[model samples]
Target: MRCLKMLVIAAVLMFGLTSCGVTNHMISNYNVSQTQLVLSKDNFRVIGDVEGRARATYVFGIGGLSRKAVRENAIADMYRNARLTGAQAVNNITTTVKVRSYPFVMEYEFIASGQIIEFTGE
Candidate 1:
């Protein structure tokens, strides 16, 4: 039946899309750098915070994934990427993930360049 065929195609498409994972590559590169720093650091701490960016947000297909899953993935990636750059936490740090959609598939980008800040405790 036509309905059955459509269902099969939809299932395949969803599976392929979800398997693609999060679209936070800039963050991924950062993670690489952060990891490198961690290897050389005498002390390390993990910080979490959120901020907004001027650029249009990015949105990837949710598929069956929850928003929490997506955000967490991005945050973890941000931490890993920051480590690659040799930037250890001076105090605390925050990175923002912006989600926006276009005509085609949604995009999920890390708007962390200017949004990140080094925390200093008094």
Candidate 2:
């Protein structure tokens, strides 16, 4: 009985000191700037992958822009690094948000990634 009590106290201390985090993820389809452009298996070839990340901190749930804006900022950052010139497009865009909580502070990290493809002559 004494050993059991000690174990319970240890467990409680461990849990109390541990911090928990939450994550939200989402994936979007093709988001090319061109609307009339048609992409097929034979029309495009995978060139490489592009990724971008953005982070913001909140205290007492007050700070930074809205969630949608943050996501857009991440995607915009990805585009800046994509270096698209011509006949290039990015698809399979995915966005993931991770929120880490500590005391009265929370940090949110957003990551956006996609596949960069270049059109191939038919």
Report every candidate's CA lDDT: 0.44, 0.82
**lDDT by residue (tens digit), candidate 1, 1-122:** 99999999999887766623344423333333243233354444445344333222333543434554555555555444554333434122334555555444554544444223332232
Error of 1 at 2 (Å): 34
Residue ranges of candidate 2 with Cα displaced over 4 Å? 1-17, 30-41
Candidate 2 has which clashing residue pairs, if any? none
lDDT of 2 by residue, 14-70 (tens): 876777699888876635563234654477778999998888888899998877777
Sequence-dependent TM-score of model 2? 0.76
Model 1 clash count equals 21
Clashes of each: 21, 0
- What lDDT does candidate 1 reach at residue 101? 51
